[model samples]
Target: MTAPAALAGFDEVEAYHDAWWDEIVAQAQAPAEVDIYDKDWRFLSTVDDAISGDFTDLYNDAGEGKLAQLAANPVAQWISENVTEAEDLHVRVTQSHTEWAGKAQTIEESMDSDGFESMNISFLHDLQHAKKIYCYPNPFFLLQVQWPKIYPYFGPSVTGVKTLLHLNLLRRYQPFWRLPADIFSKTAWAQDFEAANWPHIVNPRGTGLFNDTSMHCIIATRMGNFYDVVKAILEDAGLQLTATRWLPGDEQPFPEYATITMPTLIWDVVDKGGVRGKTGTLLDGFMPFVRSILGDNIQETKTPVPYEEPQEYSEDKWGTVKEVPAVVWYAAQRYTTATGTGQSGIVKWRKTQHKAIASAILTGGKSPGWVNTGVKLIANAILGYIGMIFLNPGLALGIFDEQIEDVILAFARADLTNLRDEMGRDAYGEYWESSGQNGFSPSTLAAFRTGQMAVQPYTSFQVEVVNGQPYWYGMHAVMGDRVSMELGMSGVLYTDQIRTARLTFGPNDPVGWTLAVGKDDDDTSPTARLARVLQAVSTIAQQIAVQS
Candidate 1:
């Protein structure tokens, strides 16, 4: 989480005053000629500025931008640009939880358990890489904070603001989707994983800011028999693969799962629908799916009220006319409650409470004074102490978040039966049926689970190879000593290309980069504020002791 910001009702009061004054002045003055196209013309000019500006400084100030630059390094760029052209491509699959497979009937059963890359079993298809690469907590949020200069041009309208967001999304988030192909080669594939793989979803994007909603992935439509090779290897180990689906006639798949169950594909969708970067509109074709899920839009209008007569219009020429009303037109300003789940307005009440609590953090719920800062410091310290100690639930040690996700999915009656099919879980599910899963002996999961095995891609093919033979091997980063594997495949896949490629160039690993941003490791982050509070408290205590 984030610290609550101080509330400055001064802004609200100033806004109301400004609106009232402007309306009164307009009522007094003669109407002037205005060009209807002026706003449109200005908007077009602003868009041009956005396209032409060198926002590197602006980007440097944003956390997301820093991560994007990391992913766009030369090695990652090479993998992203070249892998698409390769005929065969392989994506490493990762387990959702550390110990989810522990409950399985056998090692083979655990190998086929549901994981993050099990989209072929969960959603039936995977998102396309190039077409859908939008990440959120909106990178623009940070950029706008750092560079307010651009906001004056783009903040006037919803379209303008969203346009700015879309541009930032494309520039800062595209690289997230185009991450290095073999970065996770050491990891194992989930059951039902096919030609497409979305590794970004697993690591770098794991930060709370990105979450599962980040539409970043790799779809292997380019050429190559890597899928066939992996299929043979997996089947030899008595593991079945479900075919992942693709859209018909080259239509791109849905970018995120939230988009799948959305009712309408409309413009108001804040973040859902269609290929992310491919569409030119703001948020691409995505809409505010969150609002829709909550309920119908609740637009409430307040009745207009008149400004006080003596104080507001006493000195005006029309003051004597009782008929003259100095009404503040905005007294009727509308406020919408987008969430109307009909829980007796509890949602709105909670939002209000949250907003007030956030405001009180910075202001200490008091007027400005010399002691304001001290009060805020004390308030934060007290709250922080309470939260970190008494209020906090015990740390979730050794518990994988994926286990919770599995429970939720299970309660929702999610079916995992489709994951056990012999072929990839696509329309062509039977294409590889002839290749039986009886070639290799069962219980071979130990090879992948018990050793210091390093995954090495074939010199010429997408499959991993060792001593001129296709082999399966991987190491657990946390428990490298526990499991090892060296499985067999039919072909002699070479390994020269991946071995020679520069895969180690980077400022920081993407996953680590995500975890580092806004983390306590930084002196300027929220943790620093707490440190300052502690120092202040210590100083005050020392002064009191000296006085005594």
Candidate 2:
């Protein structure tokens, strides 16, 4: 069905966002006097309006066929609208020190006055110093003190903080890849079931879960960092990067991954189980785990098929021809333990039947010491599972699988290595170091430690200072340093680093007078931090209510 005509047009979307922001500001300015519930409804209404317009459905009627609809989520819409692929992107990692270091003594002396103006002046100085370092004027500094008096409930309303966190989590924990058709393809798995005289055993339909449409919305919009770009370059060169299979479901929605009966590699068994001799066929020997959601009807294949000329062998860490398994047993989908599906029959079926099948195949008939069996018990903390993807056309899901930090650092190292190679002794002047102390200047840290400052801390990379300036380098959308300003600072001091320089170029701010912060990841800016704090508080309150 087409979207309703009342849906907002493209030109009106930005205006709609502005109106919502204005309303949020007004509500935050006088929350006690405003109808908060009504405001919430209005906010939801705005989201509905933003999503009402027809969007390009990436996944064509994938499982439950709601992937397209789910893509209309506010975060997805915002990312789709705002973030575009960059071409010939040349990010200049510059070296420059923060201007605040010079004014440190002045701020400290002003703090001794014990007057309100002194505090205000110090705060302004910090903001000015912060602007020199951060991409925008530090909003956290502006709002931290004034929020209590001028805007009581302003923190949670800020955009981009939670989204950035979610993006980081996805990039860090659940990097994605497309499922290739040849090795673990739907066609091959289905053929195996039919060949085993269990035609009715495995379902043939593609769940469309790993399809580009389903995974693209979750990833491309989230990972626009330089690391992601480099990873893309590496993947284009045929490096199947391994990432944690953090998604908590044992049962794979894809039918190809439903059963575990592929011809096992000798090296694979030796690598996983440690070298032990004497066995019939490789398949019979490696049936340590196998469970099917289709009950006893789906029996394990006893007779093993010989390797019919292994086609696409991937190189392992040692550069050996590694036969990439069609589907890794442990890296399947899993669901919550909560048994009774809530009221709706659809929910019940999805929770019970679909999940049971997914869980069953995911477990693969739990053998001793198998991790997939208890996947739901332990959350993402257990980083044992590995998520793999197929990068073939029409089969790839757009998800980042590598740690962004690692990618960025690798780039820096590569760039530095090249520079050193080119200049020899000339490049020895500057170097890159990880930002350990949450990307705060010594003055900023001291101020925050003493409760004199309320700005959020950013964890960033630092390069050596050359010619009195610190070098700065980061992507257009960088990860925010997730330290809470409320928490007391407890880390070693770092100074004259690259982070003290601008991380991103503001397209709109030609003069750079924009008083915003956390534009990179959009999480640590004062407003973003405030919103995060408020959300955290709200969550705590909700938890308390539930406990009570």
Show model 1 residue runs off by greater than 4 Å. Answer: 1-157, 170-548
What is the TM-score of candidate 1? 0.15
Q: Compared with the true structure, what per-residue lDDT tens digits does model 1 show for residues 53-161?
A: 0101000111101111223234333333443332232221121111100000111111234431110110101212212332222333443343221122211122222
The parts of candidate 2 lying over 4 Å away from their true place are 1-470, 475-526
RMSD of each: 34.5, 31.2
Collision count for each candidate, in order: 31, 30
Residue 248, candidate 2: Cα error in Å is 24
Question: RMSD to the native, candidate 1?
Answer: 34.5
For candidate 2, write residues 1-548 as lDDT tens digits: 86665664754787899998676444322211100001111111122212111111000010000011124345334434543343110100111211110111111112235442111101111111111111111122232332211111101100112222222322332234222354234555454323222211222232222321111111111012212212222211111111111112324334334542321100000011112223423322223223210123222223444443233322221112233222111100111124311211111000011100110111011111223223322322233232223333233222422222222111211122322343444433322221111122221111121111012122432221111011011211111211101011222112111112221122232211011111123323596469546744654454234222
